[model samples]
Target chain A: MGKKITIEPVTRVEGHGKVTIHLDNDNNFERSRLHIVEFRGFEKFIQGRPYWEAPVTVQRLCGICPVSHHLAAAKAMDVIVGAGTGDGLTPTGEKMRRLMHYGQVFQSHVLHFFHLASPDLLFGIDGDPAIRNVIGIAKMHKDLAVQAVMMRKYGQEIIKVTAGKKIHGTGAIPGGINKHLSLKEKMSLLDGKDPMNADKMIEWSLGGLEFFKNFHKANKDLIDNFAAFPSKHLSLVRKDGALDLYHGVIRAIDADGKKILNDVDSQDYLEHIAEEVKSWSYMKFPYLRKYGPKDGWYRVGPLSRMNTAEFIPSPLAQKEFEIFKAYTNGKPNHSSMHYHWARLIEILHCAEMMKDLLNDPDLMEGELVTKGTKSYEGVGLLEAPRGTLFHHYRINKDDQITMANLIVSTTNNNMPMNLAVESATKQFISGQDKITEGMLNAVEVSIRAYDPCLSCATHAIGKLPLQVKLYDSKNNLIDKRTKD
Target chain B: MEKKQKILFYGYGNIGRQDDGVGVVFSEQLSKWVEDNNLQNIDFDSNYQLNIEDAENIKNYDIVFFVDASTKESVNNFDISSIEPNSDVSFTMHAVSPGFILNICSEIGEHQPKSFLVQIKGYEWEFQQPLTAKTENNLQKTLIFFKKYLKKLLIEKKIEEIDLKSLLKIKND
Candidate 1:
């Protein structure tokens, strides 16, 4: 048995989070825990602010996926303001806004999969820590680097064309998008329709896939290709059997793969869903309608979304469906590590949707604004780079926001993260003297597996105070300091 | 052209940790002043850390200010100072540190330029919160420094407007 170890303040992602890895009495490894520490007051803060300000305020939650926050908040607010009186997006406005949203999905997914998520797959979790970055990946795999950069670049162009900015754009006013798309931008999106970039990226992904498949094949004992755990999916499904982003009702399924409710109304979402308060940390856990702290644990965002969607929307992504459906378990191919596969699946879907939107007739022809000036209370929900987002607002007769609430996707998936870390901790904990950095990083990476956007989860990033003291066998202080 | 007194401020720190993002907060104030007052202060770029290479043309600026977090002995950010120029000016890993950025650019053949560091004293560095009370108070002091600078600049302008010919009117008579 070896000494126990602890890792506080995990790094390499947005915002703040804490990860603790437990070592056995022998000191090898026993368990791992990735806890969401920082609590964002956005949810509690918005209680008094007007709903009209929800989109604008929540958009600031994340600089990366402002569009997602904008759309999600707007959609929810729309339900509140009206039964959906075709809220102010003129024909052109709808196309433009949808394009921008999909553009974000494309770019954010690509970033998460490639830059953020790639190291775990390409280098392997226990691989060199110093080199698990874009620059390192580029050095070892130049072709992959080029393809990934191009794919990400294409996604950025989508946002630039629609919102006139890549990351954060002041698109939403009280009614509709504040900006319009230009013909030149439309031409560029059409240019991406070229089979070349997609083909090249696909080729790179295939190569990277082989590298992993081969490793798993070679190290069957160390890496179980079928190492999967069961979990329910949550997402918005269109009336037809398709994945809907812009507007659709939220749905939650059970572990038995049964839909709890086919059409969960966004207006009454707070009723069916509950965010559990954790005293140990700032992050909140969302439980199911029937399940409470005792049994109501679930997942959200990409993994949950894939579970909920009827099938993949893009041809490239559909091929994944073909492969996964052939598997016996039939629930997203089982392997939790394969979440990256689902992310790539969504990226292809987003790109395809973006292309279709560019070709939509109303995209370039109609006014960007419509008549929503009658009443200003509206909510827009954006899929965000991470997952399902909620933005609610209630404006007075003067259109001044009087109340607001934002329940971020990270808050929803916080429970799943705790679960995943526990599972990984159980596997990695061995009785030995050494508590390696690789072991600790693996626990943190599992949290990163969810692409935790602490920034969005916490509207503001501030330093309060935390300290950790390490001790030797003699009880002498080895190291202790404050976070910088 | 007077080169416009072009300066590029790099605000680099971990925002989650109080006082770490002093550079960013200070940069925000400088940015507002430049925009509202239309000063030749040029640009402010905030990052998770600092990068000296970003200061490609250091000599271009008549004055450059570097703001960041420091715990060095006897040197609190509340007490600003000038650091000696050197190669490999150390900044943070993710982004450039203000002090490291100022020195590295000078060594990298960008030519030496006048530099000042306004390091803010850090309180808590791990928890997710905004600036600590002490740091926030220090920020006010930094703002005062800028306000005084603005006033001095105004005085200099007024003094310049009084031409030598006006003072020599008796001699001309």
Candidate 2:
């Protein structure tokens, strides 16, 4: 029997998780696995609820990215409504929904980059944990911190204006949004008069891109090869192969950036994908149908979205995307650290897209919602901030939900994340009992790159506590650690 | 002229959990109370959990009261005590303790707010379970105590004289 090293509740990321590293008798690495400990039975609980309430109900799954669930559920309900009315949302309705969804993407990405990821990138991952936080960033670079807060506030404001609240907003409904953007609210965001105006947000996003570029240039090895591995990439893209977060066909690309699957409808998710469960963890591993469990594991989120999209429609974002691609020699950049870079670029795109949507005259002339024919089954898909999120539901004749299945982004990236943890552990951990905080942080960084939401991915319900244990060849615990 | 201290009532817990939501529910009531009484320089907010970002939020406030549910039955209906920022930060971003948030605030902000954790006794944590009668009674008692204590501080403008331990001892009896 070999020794084991574990790091529980990987810090600065959302939810609860633990990492276990196995070492042989000679103190050499054997294997490692990241376990999600939280359990949420959102799918089962919503069974008796009305179909229209799914949007509001599922939002409780994640406080950080509730809008993603909100919109995904609404889209699923839209399918149900479409069955009865012979159509889905009206043109105005769809446009408004897209606007709200972009706001969510913008806010979530901003929060991740500034609040969660930047603390690590700005302050070295090995820096003092006491000061390696948002506060530290504020102290070190006041201007950057101020700008980050402004940018996040701007994104949150967009969400508030569209969804009616910053976190658990109730804007999206069965067929469409309940309200349209008022002129005053729209102008407040776009006009330069406000502290967090659209111009400043765009400028800050571009500056963020440059900052990341310089950081990557300085830490080339860490940026390019840290947890770097080949895997499949998945995201949603417009029919013409443009980046589309709100509505589009699901696309899958190979490790080498070659398109393997294209234009798969969200409704047909089961036919193409299946979930494999492991007895050790609460999360379910989802992989492509063709490759089976072991080889079918794919990556999703910002890195995946950037790898699969043909071009970003927004001008500044497209320019940055070109630079991003050039860095990879026109190939998909497999470096996990680039997730931060791709995230900043997406934030730029989201900001620009928000401006474009706000300027469109149709956004102001919407009838808010469209009454659709009721359907028994529906599925909704969209690019959540973390990755592609799918919501599937089956309803009875009485309009109560009969069954619900949610494939969150974290679940889709489960296999890749485990691979990342294993790779980092093998590369960093040297001795059986010589485990350093830096070694643990290296593993944490790999998982943070994915921004996994364990609270939303798990199906069980209870308190999730994380513990890291180190064992000797005799399988006796030599060192044990926990975060409380 | 002495500056009127800006106060923040921050209540955080998961509302979906039965009595674990007492802090949030209490904050809601306090917000309405503040508005009804037209208390100036007072702010209120609640969420499912606290995060590292909340450090920046508390920077400008002069005083902050962090209200959360405590499962300890031996304690008083609610306990109030001063809290200092600790260097330890949680591994997860989903939830953070008030002391840690304070530590971050003190580390980054130009000023550190005088803070206290108002822990109310909670009995249940089941999903979708309503607040227990005991929790409700405790919540009412805590709210009544805060209403008087805050009025005194706000009217007298003597934040320094507001003794947290004395208040706890008095409320315990």
Candidate 3:
């Protein structure tokens, strides 16, 4: 009989997800799907609320990337308040927000690469499960472990400084920010004691790149070929085509590096992209409107951002970006494992940006807010650490939000993740008579490449425990395994 | 007079999620009480959840209390248990266990703080809802017990010397 294998609460990625693989009686792989079990009702929940509360209210959606939601909502409201999309803010306003964003991307990517992705790279997919985690990394590579923890701390410190608190930060408001960076705060972050300062962060970021490059050089086959596939890429880029995580025009390119969607105003995202609902998953798959559901699917996040941008604005990261692009001969990289390389490069860029922002005098002085004529509808788009994020809203005359839609980064990468699972299954589990832990891990490693935050995608939670079940074509259970 | 040992009460949970906020609320309430009572050698911090960097935060203190909400059936109104270093890897970094944080501290810091988990039983976890009546009552009981127990630890004995069993016997329930 044919067999079906299910891996529940796929391990080491944010939030809960399940992978199901089907095979013929001969144990040859047939197909696979990644099911998102939770349902997110944040849009309906925010319908009756005042529009001004959207930024803070939306944060209740996900703890993993609340800042992304916070800023995205704020940007949408910026348009609602006629703040000219993203550029109308005061020097202090825009700079502070950028600082906060770089901090978020810096910390988020660091966590993904070091805490989540490094284990799979350091210990092969078949390494002892007992020692295949950050804890294991700490036991063996103490220095790297310490650096990851410290780098996370530094990014969080930046968040705390800019957002005004650890949780439910209200720093970014419509029209502009509420406060400016204090001189003391600037000095503390810019020239803090050993290891906490921006200089040290830049140094460590370079070291991180070196570490990944060394690993890549030694394990080129695994790094370059694992789950490699072709797909279109999308992200927001600066007017001049530099990588801009904060604000820019939406751009997407094909698998062969041709612009399918030219640089366009984010306000018209609906005209360019659409989300398709699938019966199997709660999350929606987003695709380019022109290509339709069948072929419009595109990749997002760090690797996509690398492919879409023409260059890195910062000096150090720009150098690394050239090497990354040249490796593929300036073509878009389709290898899922290369996401780590792209993420590490962004980390270095963020560090350099932070150093420059810290030295800028405007962060400490200038107008804090701007007022303008109001509008009822707005759309906000930004490149989140994982990928491109969209926040759209329409409010009534009473300033109550009548409609709200959020297409989170994870949701945008839905199709890609499913494809990755399918690819890994073909490579590792095809023709296997029995499912092993290593085989299951191979499937997970592919999804982990995108660092999908299912919490943000589903915007919901459930009983998340790890388990795998095997069943015969008759739907009779054959084997089962679970882990806490 | 001997120098007073530094103590930290770190609570973590998502405040937006009704009863799930109990841990953060506990810390916030305790922070006010500490200020009002002019308490010394005590500090409080709260966040949506605990992360790896908390290992660095706890190393400076002599006693660490990790407050959290629990859904386990065995937990009564509230429960206090000792925490030992655990390096078992979790499926995600969205949040890590207190024991895991302690383990990281032991690995990197000079000395691990004496740590315990104060688990307040919570009932509801709906979004944007207030704490259910039953959970609020449990929280109050846990808070009252902690206030008294902390005073006793300060005035009567060294925190490291306090018996963990005594805490289990004195559950607010």
Question: In TM-score terms, which candidate is top?
Answer: 3
Error of 1 at B51 (Å): 13
Query: How far in Å is the alpha carbon of A371 misplaced in model 1?
Result: 3.7
Give the per-residue lDDT of model 2 (tens digit) for A205-256. 8888888889988999998998999889999898899999888888999988
RMSD of 2: 3.0
Q: List-wise, what DockQ does each model earn?
A: 0.06, 0.41, 0.70
Which has the higher lDDT value, candidate number 1 or candidate number 2?
2
Which stretches of model 1 miss by more than 4 angstroms?
Answer: A1-4, A21-32, A44-51, A80-89, A166-168, A192-228, A370-382, A462-484, B1-173
Report how far residue A246 has shifted in candidate 2, in Å.
Answer: 1.5
lDDT of each: 0.59, 0.81, 0.90
Q: What share of the true interface contacts does each candidate keep?
A: 0.00, 0.39, 0.63
| Chain A TM-score for predicted structure 2 | 0.96
| Cα displacement (Å) at residue A209, model 1 | 6.3
Chain A TM-score by candidate, in order: 0.85, 0.96, 0.99
Residue-wise C-alpha lDDT for candidate 1, range A432-473, written one tens digit per residue: 344455655566666776777776676665332223334444
> Lowest summed lDDT over 10 consecutive residues: which window, candidate 3 chain A?
A456-465
Alpha carbon lDDT at B155, candidate 2 = 88
Task: Assess candidate 1 and give its TM-score to the true structure.
Answer: 0.71
Report, for candidate 2, the interface RMSD.
2.9
Arranged by DockQ, best first:
3, 2, 1
Best by DockQ: 3
**Candidate 1 lDDT tens digits, B105-166:** 45332455566665767666642448888888877776776556545555565423322243
Interface RMSD of 1: 8.9
